[model samples]
Target chain A: MEVNEYNACVREWADALFRFACKCTGQASDAHDVVQNSFEVLWQKRKEVETGKAKAYLFQVAYRKSIDHYRKKVKITFAAPPEETYTPANPDLKKILDRALAQLDDQARALVLLKDYEGYRYEEIAQITDLTETQVKVYLHRARKILKEYLVSVENII
Target chain B: MISWENYEEYMMMHADGELKPAEAQELMAFLDANPTLKSEMALYDLTRLTPDESLTYHDKNSLLKPEPVKRVISFPKWRKYAIAAGIALLVFVSLFKYIDTNKNNARIAKTDTTKPIIPEPANNTSNKNEPQPQQEPKSIAATTVQPAKVTHATHHDIHPQITHNKQLANTKQNDNALVNNITPAAKATTEISSLPITTTKPLPSEIAMASPPMATIPAYEITPPAKPTKRSLIDRLPIDEANKRQLKTIAHITSGASRSVSKVKEEIDGNAITFNIKNNNIHISF
Candidate 1:
């Protein structure tokens, strides 16, 4: 793909990618960086990539970048992971949800996001997360069960 | 009939729309029968909506913020290509130089093993039966080739006439003339005359078979009368020039050899030269 065509696609997907990255990372600044860098990385490998799959490619790059950020942050601090984000504006519910989500592991949290928020099918989630289709289904089922259990307990606590 | 124990899977899959048509119908029937289960499913569905709203808020805020200054993704293509080419050229030139030097060394070694052949002058006699001079041409050539010997001959105390005459006679006279004139009777007479005197250095025994027969004329004698030798102005200039040229050639050879060795050593340290003893071949490259 040409640079202009790539830039056009970047322009097209930038907001959606930012939204997905924001959902994944929960930090506006980090989400913007993730979106920009994903597009930039896509542009670098633009010759080998197809224009039709560019959006999906951008999301994949953003996903990996967000995960890398989480891993790096985890190493430096033992605080709550970024994905289980709670904001001050909706402190009560946000705290409950954050507590619930944090109870699940990294892959479980990612699986929940990819499946529930992104509406990805087990097969698509498998492809995106580099898991087998069976593993995706199993992981998503287990993650949902864990979230459901946490949410029930959180409702009781709140 | 889905059990209550797996009821959450039914609710989640129903929410996800992953349940097959028949399975969805069964799940729907089950939820219709259980109002509490339907309410629980609704609450889980509510929790799912919150993340999306947060995501939209964050996304809008990010989009509202001014886009980042586009970072110039510098490729450095030219510098990369130039560096690659330079390394390739260095490796190529070093390898060629090494091979050429090795070939030259091999040739020199081969030449060193073979003895050099030197041609001796044959006797040209005016008499019917004249004896031949037996001189080893190889030794004569080796000794004659030494410039130091020529300088010594000119330096030592001796008859200047005799030495001058001797050098000339050696050049112009054949072996037969040298053999005849160097005999004691002929030499004494020749010395008395203003005529040039020639001397014959005795041949080594190995060369005696080829030497002229001992004439009753006393085979060899012509000692130059001792006198303080005058250093001639004529010989010095030519000898100095010859010495200078020899030194320059030696210096050139040494410098060339040293440069070649240094280039080879550089290639070795750089790991550019690979010798494959199994294949009996060498490959030098980047």
Candidate 2:
């Protein structure tokens, strides 16, 4: 991709990539880092990428960076109790949804983000997450089941 | 195909908008038949996350790159070579002109120094018939004598007296007889006879010194000098005192050889060798 096309990708897809990173990483700061790193990788690989594929390329980079960040966070804080991880001052629907997204693993969360947030097809998500289409469909369905269960839970729904 | 075992997959695909329209209708019909599963499908619909429009990357300007600059002018290979060749030719022509100018200046200086300066004679006597007394031949140092005011004289006009005296000296048997004929007054008059004589009027003193019979002396002609030539310029250059001594020594040697040669030739064929020291010319009678 040329510079202007890469920059156009940034303008069109940066917010969506950031939201996907935010949902996968579960922290605004980590999401910013993931977004920044994803664009940096895209810029570095601009010559190899085409303008049509730049959005997918960016999401792929952000998905990998988020997985790495999530792994590092898990390794460092493995002893911490899951109940103490999120303490929302005011629990709204968006905060409840965030807590439910945090319950899924990094890969499942990225699959959900690519599916719902970016509206990528199963095949495109499989390409970005480097999984087979069947794996993506199974993982995304499982994630949706977990989110449905969390929303129906009486304590969490309130 | 929509059964309880595979019902959740249809719900997820329907929520993701991946199901075909007929399958979506089939799932809705199956949900209508199973009234309790209708609420389960609604919960699946809630799983689709709507992107918050307020969420944005604030630092997106940093990712943009500037456009590449365009070149204003470019030269072809032939044009560059032509420019270089033109510069080289201009320098070569300038150097050649500079060298040629220097050579011309040097040639002018050399010509000025070697040019002969012909001057008029002090005594303008040009009497051709009178036998003038011969002057004692001076060394080459006498060449530096100051020139007279008159600008030019031919060899015949200037040296008529010398030619007459030479013929007389040739006829006499003894050199002392020729020396006795040169009176003291004539000797004084001919002191600077090395200079050309241009005047045609005869002096009273020369008429008195003409005691020898003019009829006995064979008439000889001296050629006149024309415009100065290269040989004349070389002859006019001043010789140093040392060079004059060397030339005198060479002249003495040559004179001795000439005397011996004269005697031998006179005995064999009545011909003689005559050497003139004043002008460095050798005459041979054959």
Which candidate's TM-score is highest? 2
Candidate 1: CAPRI quality band: incorrect
For candidate 1, write residues A79-119 as lDDT tens digits: 34344323445446555555566566656666777676567
| Residue pairs that clash (backbone atoms under 3 angstroms), model 1 | B134-B211
Candidate 1 stretches with Cα past 4 Å from truth are A75-99, B50-286
Each model's DockQ score: 0.12, 0.46
Local distance difference test scores for all models: 0.60, 0.70
Query: Evaluated with lDDT, which candidate comes out highest?
Result: 2
Work out the TM-score per prediction.
0.42, 0.47
Q: Residue by residue across B155-204, what tens digits does model 2's lDDT show?
A: 22233344346664353334435545789886554433323333222233
Kept native contacts, fraction for each prediction: 0.20, 0.75
Chain A alone, TM-score for each of the models?
0.74, 0.84
